[model samples]
Target chain A: MKSTLKKAGYSRVQKQMHDVFLQFTSKVVFFIIIMFAFNLFFAGHYTPGGGFVGGLLAASALILLLIAYDRKTLFKMIPIDYRLIITTGLFLSLAVPTLSFLFGTPFLTHQHTYLQLPVLGEIPLHSALLFDLGVFLTVAGTTLLMIALIEGEES
Target chain B: MTTDILVLLPIIIPMFAGLIMLFIGRRPMAHRVGAALTGLLMLIITLWVIIRVYNSGTMVTFIGDWAAPFGISVVIDMAAALLLLSTTIVTFAIVVYSFQSIGMEREKFYYYPLILFMLTGINGAFSTGDIFNMFVFFEVFLIASYVLITLGGTKIQLQEGFKYIVVNIVASNFFVLGIAYLYSVTGTLNFADIYLKLDNYDGNIIIMTIVAVVFLFVFATKAGVVPFYFWLPGSYYAPPMPVIALFGALLTKVGVYAIARTYSLFFIGNSAFTHQMLLFLAILTIIVGAIGALAYTDMKKVIIYNILIAVGIILTGFSIMDQTATVGAMYYLIHDIIIKAALFLLVGFIIYRTGKVDSERLGGLIGQHPLAGWAFFIAALSLAGVPPLSGFYGKLFIVQSAFENNHYIAAIILLLSSLVVLYSLIKIFINVFWGEDMDFSKLKPVKYDKLLVSSIGLVIVSVAFGLGADLLYPLFEMAAEAFHDPASYASYLTEVE
Candidate 1:
């Protein structure tokens, strides 16, 4: 799939776009964003941070990498098709409600309980965590897929 | 217990099936087979529910075991079951028709999943008892439609799709505003609870009237009523035949359904004012649609305009707010969903075979595709309310109620629009099918068996639906009963607690 931008001969006339310092910092920024995104995701059930926000945060980190690197390197590093990611996220989300069907509960019924973890003592566990994970994956996958398509067109 | 809970299946099945289809990578044949099976499964489930609702009366299920009034309620009364049944049938037909007509490349681009999601939304819209939840389902389908309309990526499609989205998004904002107003006034999103609350409220009734009219504006835009219908004809014309059939048969009807649901259930307090206003707009809608249907020589626009006309007639019945008229609206709504789907599929097949949209360019298709020609004839008559066909009983009851209600002008226009419908379709039949077999560049032997089977299948169903109106009368009556006597519906909700 040849891009229109490439076809327009702008690639030859344009200046070399990458800056050395910016590239190194982007990698650092990507890791930090991913870590913070997970924190927000885990805290989402009680706090304001949930799947939708966390997914966007994580997707933005990957988008930074795409901006700094080429499509070839990006795909080589993470080879999963973006569409698959979206499907997986949706399945996970739907699975939670579907499980409720098996449990003889109503649709979208989520059960929560307290769990004793070896390292974490008493912790809250929720079926909605899986549902939120689905939302997170879907948001991240959809954002990145859209950006990837637009990036292909432009660069 | 599980059997009662099957109320959620109509919405759930489609989403689950579509996602699973997406999961299994793209194989065009697999997608077609999978989607066809899913549609069939949904059709069977809907039929069973419709029958059970007919025998047992209205059924309600609350999500997450949340009690009524506080949690989301999924209701399957006679009206909703009827809508679901027809929607599923049409969906099945469209899926089968797309097998032959929609190109493999496009099918590979997740067409089946889009169809499934749209089904999910349509089913959700029909079954939901919560007003806010209805808006959510509307978005689910509208988003799917945004992609379906522009699937081929034609310039016309993109342009039309953009306008279609803009119109709907703005309308949806109004939908939310209407909900907000209703919520503020009633302190409830549940339809049953709102019904109970609005009845007891002593506040200024004027605000409720404004909220009703605001909803009227929102739904009329979606249903393609006059003044707001400018975008409908163009948008409907841009999509491929199957997509067009889906929009023509289902989407606008969702709007019509919203109007009927809201008006009959919650907004009847000031009947004289709100219903009269509804009647006025419905008349104008029918007039504009009748004129537009005749104005177009292009087969697609004619059928598209006919969609608006059907919406008008159904709404007119709803606006009358009488037992007979409400039953007429429900019956007509079901009939229109089926017949319009059949008409669009038939029209689509012609365009596919002849490769021409204009009736002037096409000639003597009956000589080559006699089966399609005959099916279109039956569908046209059915659409025009010729006796014993699908459209007749609905229109007959509507006209009868219009007279009973002393809505003399509405009754007359309702009768006149039937003539326009007949003439417009016969014009297509005579011009396109009855001409001298004119040669065309794309007159190759196209494989049309799958398309024909599916489209003709709907034609068969329409005929059956018409002939079986006697047996179906009880179902239609029960559907109408809920509107007139809300005691059963209200009591059911009260009993839930």
Candidate 2:
């Protein structure tokens, strides 16, 4: 046992340690969750799903990536500042609502219509959808940013 | 509809400015210019809007074509406009002051954006015609303030900011709880609609009073009314000068505004009990706050405690709920916001100059910086409601109304509260500015020109507001009318569906 330990210790091992399963599962799950978030966001226009929940779901997917990898790698992959995301989200939410003011409508007047596309079937389109997108970005951004701040504080 | 859109501008403009600054990113000069311009624009817009409202009636907008009783509504009644006017003036001055005082580090680290965002919340809270919307705006500002209090990330700040956050979170929960209970009882959240629904509410009166009391408790905590004031001094002490000035100037007043609003609007169902309860609390708050001011030799604590005293006096007038008294309260409210912000800036400057907060360590600034010394003295006198300055007329009207209502004790206490205010403030003057001049050669130099300029501007407003009370009286009278007759403010709402 002592000879075997000395043999292992004396050897210069250059192989990198890796969480192969975690990396693979996280990559697969990230896309799946993102797809689900988009679906939820779109479905919010007519059904029970909406931007807030969709945003949270999307954030969780990113959080999963963060857990599997690390903050440095996750941020490198996304290359987006979360504070910018938050402010942009806020701007989007604010701008979308006030779009009515230009058209001589009271603030936040939403409009919707049914439309036919070249390949897709009939679908509903709404200003509220844009609003929901804003909400989605805001919730997602706020959650991730707060987590990042807390993490930075601890370190 | 044009005027209707103006109701949303106060909230929208500051928010848009804040976002634009965020997008601009890290340009200190640009941030300062943007902040100053936004502050100026707010002043202009509020002035214009107030003029329009004065000429016409209240401006009400139903967001997204939502009617007054159902969807989100924005109303710029006489009272809201007046409050907004005062708010803009204070914010503008603070913005200007922040240029020199709020250190470069905090400035680059999103200070202007946070201040503007806080402005957006304040304007929203004042103009929102929905109770639920008011709570949302409260959260909006409170969140900004949380970041602001911890802006520099100092140890004392973190400790105090934590307590501030905890206290506010609990108050917000109570606020939501109160709103929920009120909604459950009234079947509505719009202020006027709730009034309409509760006019003949066959529901239990006990539940209604309980809910009203709950709201009172919540706002009292926000406004730092006596028993609930434990967190105020410590939390306020934690931040930098400009941030503290912002808070002292505006935050507590929002709470005062909320209390005035609820009591005047939906809670009048049992004013005899509810208002009497308010009167008792206001008196108790005054007594406790005056005692606090006396006990503290620390400059900041003395000024912070003065805020509580001002709140008590304002609410004392409001509790009477008469035409004269509401006018008095509104006058005093505006006056207090201005003077308190000025006093805070002045005191903050003193602390910055001396690197000392205890009055015992500060002395005879009058010999060196006579302008600051005299500014503090005048502001101190004005704060005590000395006649020929801004604070006197409000106190006079309050005492007159109290005597008219035969609440003789309240009147007497209010009268004596002024004396206490005078004594406490004068004590600071004597201790800090009256004795031998502190050794200036040993003290580090500070850039006092701009700081003095900004704070003195507010002091001038207080002086003008007092001297030119006649010119402003019509606006205050209109506000008082709005207070007495809710229907005049309500009749503008166009029903939908």
Candidate 3:
């Protein structure tokens, strides 16, 4: 397939152009900033920045790296399995409500507190925020994994 | 004694499950574990909601200590709860069916989470007190569905899925706009609040009708009503069977549920105008759907078209707006969810076994797989509204309701459409299962594990509703009452806190 693409006059410069255009600018900083904006705007929703936006940001970052470097380099840098990211997100989201069940609160009844983290100072950890973060990670990881599979088809 | 968690459980469980599925979806074992656990949890939650509503009355929950107009709320009256229960059952069956059909290669980590999110949307639509929340939930489910529909990322899947995504996104934007206009006019998003406000605003009836019509078009697209239904067949035909079955069973019904909920609660006075429009659309939908079904040779495509038929009948029943008709529509909606899912799964099984879905190329499966053939037969019979099955009761109720309302022409069309549906289904049965034995020497006998499980589950469910009509009749009646009486729902929320 690589040889066929090469034979078809696919140049490294074109690839580099794509890496610069589609991957670097769109995926890394812009994607993250867009996600932050989405969350900040929709925070009135009681849940900050939804999972969908978060997922897009994370996935774009990975896709950018994949385009800038080779797949092998991309793979090595992200040594953690994509599945683990998704699973951990799922677990954290489920854990909050499941723990609420133990306390006799209805499922997803939000609980919150402020915790002091030496250098980070007091940070509020609302269960809803945790839920949102879970959504973000899962969306990001799963979407990246899907894009990876699609990109892999080229090889 | 305590506030009812039953109403809230369906929404919360699936949201939690989606979150968990996101994390655990990468491993097949973990995915299965997560799927099974969530399925069981949903089933239990549904059954518990049923029992609670049966014992104490409707379930209502408020969010963030806010009253109905001030904050988000969830309400599960009998109708909503019944739909929620059916959705849970269908989703559980589909999830179980997916275990075998969606092999590890395609059961990507995101699949389970997407399904859960899809369920969250369905449940949220069923239980949400606010219209805006319903729109939000609809978007949630819609986005998840777009992802699920295109899970495999085939060129065709992507092509068709893009159309599906674009159409739904447009509809959702329209839905948001409709809700904004509704909120501006009524000063509230809660269903009960809207209903109450609507009663006082007799002067702006024209504007109200226009908004209602806008909502009708938005939901019509979602429900696959005629003219707006073109996207359904092509897009649905692109997905894998399990996913298609899930979509066939649940997605359009959510749209129908929204239409039913909104019209009943807020637009009761405008039924005469709305019902006439619905009647026209419903008739067109039935004819179009039946014709589309006949046009398709592939079993999955035929089933997709038949789903549109079911949507039409349910809408037709709703259009009549009589109590009995509403009851019939509710019954049909539930029955269709079970039978259609079963039919889709069966077709999936056949495709798996034969590696061909075109009816013209397939034959003689009855002798080879008696279990599957028989299950398909029963499901088809139920779908055709044959006597002694659940399907008959729904049609019977709708027809009787039509006659009661003196809608002779509408009643005739309903019966005629059923006959067309029957013929289409029979064509499939004869072509795929009974005619000539196709060569199977080269093909290994495919295991119909998920098909068998879900088929049996659906068959038993349909039978229970059929044989125990008396027992289920009151449930349908209760659903009708819940829909008709907005006060009961409104009072419950206000009374709760």
Compare the candidates by DockQ and give the number of the best one: 1
Encode model 3's per-residue lDDT on A92-149: one tens digit a residue. Answer: 6666655665666655677888899999998776777777667766777778777777
Order of the predicted models by lDDT, top scorer first: 1, 2, 3
Q: Which candidate, 1 or 3, would have the higher lDDT against the true structure?
A: 1
In candidate 3, what are the lDDT values of residues B1-497, reduced to their tens digit?
23355667787777776666554446676777787788888888887887788777877666654656767778777788788888888888888888878767677646787888899888898888899888888988988898898887789899999999999999888998898888788888888888777866765677788888989989999999988998998989898888999998999999998888888778766777887888889888988988888888878888899988899889878887667888889889999998888888888888877888898898887988888888888888888898889889889988998888787987888898778888888888899888988896844576676668886788788778777876878778888875656666577545655
lDDT of 1 by residue, B273-377 (tens): 999988888999999999999998999999998988999999999998889998999889999999999999998888888788899888887878889999999
Cα lDDT tens digits for candidate 2, B1-497? 63267889999999999999999898888999999999999999999889988998778888878666788889888889988999999988888888878889999998998999999999999999899999999999999999999998899999999999999999999999999999889878998787767766777888989999999989999899978989999999999988898998899999999998888778878888999999999999899889989999998998898898999999999899898899999999999999999999999888878889999887888887789889999999999989899999899899999999999999999999999889988998888888987888866587778889999999999999999987889999998876777666566653322
TM-score of each: 0.95, 0.95, 0.85
For each candidate, the DockQ is 0.50, 0.50, 0.24
Q: Candidate 2 docking category?
A: medium
Please identify model 3 stretches exceeding 4 Å from their true place: A1-155, B1-3, B442-444, B494-497
Runs of candidate 1 exceeding 4 Å displacement = A1-16, B1-3, B440-442
* Model with the higher lDDT, candidate 2 or 3: 2
Model 2 ranges with Cα > 4 A deviation: A1-18, A153-155, B494-497
Prediction 3 global C-alpha lDDT = 0.80
After aligning candidate 3 to the native by TM-score, how far in Å is the CA of B66 from where it should be?
1.7
Q: Which candidate achieves the best lDDT against the true structure?
A: 1
